[model samples]
Target chain A: MASLGSIATAPLRAEREGDKNAKSIVFLGLLWFAILFAVLALVVLLVTAFFDGRTRLDADLITQYSSTVFPERAGARAAILGSAMVIVTTAALAIPLGVAAGVYLEEFADPRRWYNKLIEVNLTNLAAVPAIVYGMLTAGVALSIGLPRRVVLAGAIALALLVLPVIIITTREAMRSVPQEIRQGSLALGATPLQTVWRQTLPSAIPGIATGSILALSRALGEAAPLLLLGGLVFVTYDPNGLMSGFTTSYRSRSSTGRHSHSWRFSRSHRQPLSCFWSCCCS
Target chain B: MECDGVDVYYGDFKAVCDVSLGFGYNEITALIGPSGCGKSTLLRSLNRMNDLIPEARVEGAVTFHGQSIYAKDVDPIEVRRRIGMVFQKPNPFPKSIYDNVAYGPRVTGMKAADMDDLVEEALTRSALWDEVKDKLKQSAYGLSGGQQQRLCIARTIAVRPEVILMDEPCSALDPIATSRIEDLMAELRDDYSIIIVTHNMQQAARVADRTAFFTALADETTGDRTGLLVEYDLTNKIFSSPADERTEKYITGRFG
Candidate 1:
């Protein structure tokens, strides 16, 4: 009780004692410096990118095609469409499967089983496997399976695999966050273990699952490294109409155009806003 | 309900050793002990709730009526259905009052048609229907702490379990709520066989028909701890004249 009371009043006494300590002020300043350091970098990137691409912030940026004929009329319409399709397809493939795998591991899988232990170790290591490796794997599989190269399906599949581990891990964490008491309450009421999980634990974990899934999706969306390895749809001039339609990502359009077309490139001297605008969006 | 030389273990460490007790039909039996005494563990083992813990295992015979519950052929789900429990905290599902009580029956494959009557009877029996009946559609979380516990009890009883195990059910509740629950327990004593694990001696004396005293003995040399059942008898007799020194010390608040 005395210790608890001391803890309650400790802050006031701490500041009084801290008044004469110059090290404390330095420590506070160092903490603020650390905070501002990170914030400043992100702010600078966004602000510079914003200023450089302010003129290209028009419907033309999204609606125009990538054109050698008329570079100004060139828009990222195809890439935007392609990225959206790939992300949607990736979500469709990953969400249910990842969440299900997560639920299985957390709720049912026994660590005593050798196969389950192997899976547990593999999940952690799989999350560390580079996204580009998935793209290469997708490419090899697509070639072996006689599927066409450079289509939206290839990109979606690669991204889905890339994010699957993340989704599973997050879903497991989310489900784990639901208090065990809830499970006990359900089971104590004669509900089966399956029923307890389905009715109580899952619903309670949804908010956490949603937050985790969105973070994983956003990270996948911003990625450009994986798309580089997949075939044909690198720089498209038309909108993606289907899963098989040839397409370019918004990042790919800017990067490919910048690499091949030097005159339209956004070098330091020539701060072409549309090219930098896509870079900002990707970051 | 009876357990013969039952021992509970978590992994290789024995939590409770050679514990035995029998509960009478339609009686409230209280298990009182300090922390780490495994009173809660013994309570959980009664309905096979210990099966939920991966490392937990039990030995010896635990029987409901004449049938050994731990027998290989007996379905644990069926055992749990016959013996329900209420936890220390009031953990109502994040659902409406009606849905919370309706959950137990619905999960047990009881028909939806008879659910209304069961829910009402459960709530009334647990002394929560009058307060919550008007807003059955409202979230169970909106109720006060005491009210939520009664609702939990109502939900537990909705499935019509023969025995109810309570693990410090009123520990989180205030005095008023605690008293209400105590009153409800007396009313419930006519129908349900109850075994409650309580830390409070007064609560055990106030409500329990029979009381079992438990204490954890720690080895000084090895630093190993195991829970032992000290004494059990009529509530009055155990309180007034305990059989074991540990039980007498604990009841007199001198054991520590």
Candidate 2:
């Protein structure tokens, strides 16, 4: 009987010890997570401050464009122009197309349909694919069409393809967030389904779609790989005068509405057809 | 208003079956029933609100102003524009109080100069102008439940609809708010045909000119559940001494 008591007590003592150790481990894990987060945040802050604190940054960065090695000549003019061209073109191509596709999928397409499910799965997978793959595809297509391998148009197209999935996903989520009741309410008021979507549902989702487009544009702006593959010139001395020209001048001009309305005429003209194709093709 | 052999189906499940009722112009008609008894469904069918549900199928002839509403050429949008609805939950749009009242007018292309006068008239008629006159630009979502419901009523009135449908508009409001809405309904009955569905028998007794009692029936052959109107008559007659034993039992809380 004494031996049995000792056996049970021995296991109980081990369990108690184990519980104490487990608690300590959890406490340590939480402490480590906090320390790691703080360190990462500090690193990001320091890097940003260091870049922003440079004395060389001035109006020259905005006005005199180029990346000359000489300190006096070095400016972000061409880089800014290139970035603007890419970003604007991306927005012109991506926003309408992405949003239309998203709306069709979320509002019109049946989720249970095999074709719709296939399209949805493909879009998700496309979002995860590397941007470089898109660049390669663009290059191949351009080459086949007897066009130059590395052109602004090619880069814009590549970037659009790369970010299209993301824009669609975000737009779908935004449209989905609108209450079903709101749609019903609008329809009940005798508004046509098209009118209900355009006036009620779409208006409510504008903020979300705008936010998504901005995020996609920001990602496209910072991307170096696809542009590098598309032969984005690192240095350009003059501003682009036409759709076929390389980025040469920054185009971030202020408008009356305080919104970034890009004046890329070529891209804007292409928007209607591209959006139509996007909705039809995707759905 | 008249419904001839109207049946409502949600996909294959029959929700309301074989209902025929007529509502007079400028009269308050109240539909009262237990939960899932198709009172709301029947009410929604009046304005074709059931069309919003993809699977909801309605089979019958509903005539408005001596014209069949379900005719092939009839535009549901126009019908809805003529027949306005106030929902059970008092859903005011997420806009300014003034905007909420002006939405219907704006959608129908009412002149901008006329909107201010229209908004004020609707709000006054709904009895909300006195409380919200100082804050016309404020968000409609900030209003109390009662106030929001009144705003919805004001919104419906702005469209100048001929008929107004209320699906338990006061179900979510307090008694004071309910009384306010009831008063507004009485006022509105002079200008518009009002059809209300309510679970509260007392509310129907207080405001309705005519009361309809609907009950669910289980079909043995088809094994389907459907709603059918049990009895409808003058509100006082139905409340005080109903001819049907079931109506008396239901009103007296003896059984549903």
Candidate 3:
């Protein structure tokens, strides 16, 4: 406490007085500069992304989908709803399985067992696996399962596999932060293993596990590759009405908005597609 | 309750070796030793609490009432309920004091009608009733360190275990707090059998009926330290005229 007071009361050292405090002050300034730079960059990007097409955006933008022939009729409603449905379904598919696996590993598994050690190592490697790999894996599994190639469920399945390892890891990490003493106390009371975990461990880890799963889901939401594999990048003039129906993402459709209508200054014929998508691509 | 030829290990690393001790019924036994002597490890093994550690392995038989607790049919959870534990640090659940005391009984399927009485009896037994009675609904974290430790004791006793294992329960507390806990131990000695692992010899002298002295055998070259029990006797004899020279040195504060 005395040393802290001395440091706080110390005189400002700058320029020729180049002491450790001078370096410390400079480091603090650099930290502020770094923070401001990151914040400013994000603000600029968000402003452009939101307001760039804001003047032309309306209820129709959220109620319709892109069209190949009529640019004025094109909207991003299908894509927006598609992403939302896919994310929600992804969370449902992933959270339960991840939490179960984490509880088993943290609360039950014998670490000395070779299989348990293998699982620990594999989860770390899986978290780093490329999103595109999951996209390919999803494509194969979806085809094998006889699921429609382009659907919200297939997109969600891809993302669930992508984020599963992360949720398990985070759940384990969260549960681990709860001191072992709590578990012992619960068990010493003669609470069954499942009861102890359900009553004590899981309750405490809920916030941490929730935070981790949210972060993982957000990361998955930003990923377009898996969704693209499910034909998410294509232009759809119709909204998805079922789990197996085709869909798109606003990532391209919103930007694709005003492409041939208001945002364009060039000849309209060059940007507008024919009603047939294949020939439109050929052209 | 007794363990015969008990050896505790973390994976292949032997922490404590070849320890055999019998805990007398309704008595306080202090397991005293320096750091790394595995007194805590042995205490944990008695109630099958060591099984919680994935790598921790306990070899040999730990029997409670003539039944080997390590037998496949003997559930560790059931054993833990029969033998409770108090930890070095005061770790009350982030719960109301009333709920904290009720947690054990609630899980063990105690009748709702009997719960209020049980919580009160446990708190009163631990000498924390008067202070916390007004704030039973308040969070247990609001209590002082000494009070939290006592609350933990109350929580443990709420289930009515036959034995209680205390691993440095008073070390985190002040002297006054330590004395309060020691006095509580003396009062509790007529009911539950207690096995306490303590670093304070004076504390052992004050509260324990029997004292077991442990020491670590160190291999300087390999840097391996394995704990072994040096002596076990009546507390007075161990403190005054110990059989082993090492025990005498340790008791006199002349041993490293």
Model 3: DockQ score:
0.76
Tell me each candidate's TM-score: 0.88, 0.82, 0.85
lDDT by residue (tens digit), candidate 3, A1-283? 5676566664665546454577889998999999999998667645554554465567765666665565555666776787788888899999999999999999888887999999999999999999988988888887898877778888888899999999999999999999877887888788998998999999999999999999999988878777777666466666678778777655232233444332111112333332123223322
Off by over 4 Å in 1: A1-56, A251-259, A262-283, B112-114
Question: How are the candidates ranked when ordered by TM-score, highest leading?
Answer: 1, 3, 2
Write the residue-wise lDDT of candidate 1 on B138-235 in tens digits: 99999999999999999998898999999999999999999999999999999899999998899999999999998888878767788989898999
Sorting all predicted structures by DockQ, with the top scorer first, yields 1, 3, 2
lDDT of 1 by residue, A1-283 (tens): 4776556543544546644579888988999999999998678766766775577678887778777566555677777788789899889998999999999999999979999999989999999998889889988998999998688888888888999999999999999989998998888877888998899999999998998889989888877767778864556777788888887775333333455433122423235455456544543
lDDT by residue for model 2 over B1-256, one digit each (tens)?
A: 9988999999999999899999988999999988888999888888888876778889988999899988899998889889989898877767799988887787766566777899999999999999999999999989999999999889888888899999999889999999999999999999999999999999999999999999888789986768999998999999999999989999999974
Best by DockQ: 1
Candidate 1 residue pairs that clash: A64-A75, A65-A75, A150-A231
Interface RMSD of 2: 1.7
lDDT of 3 at B36: 97
lDDT of each: 0.86, 0.81, 0.85
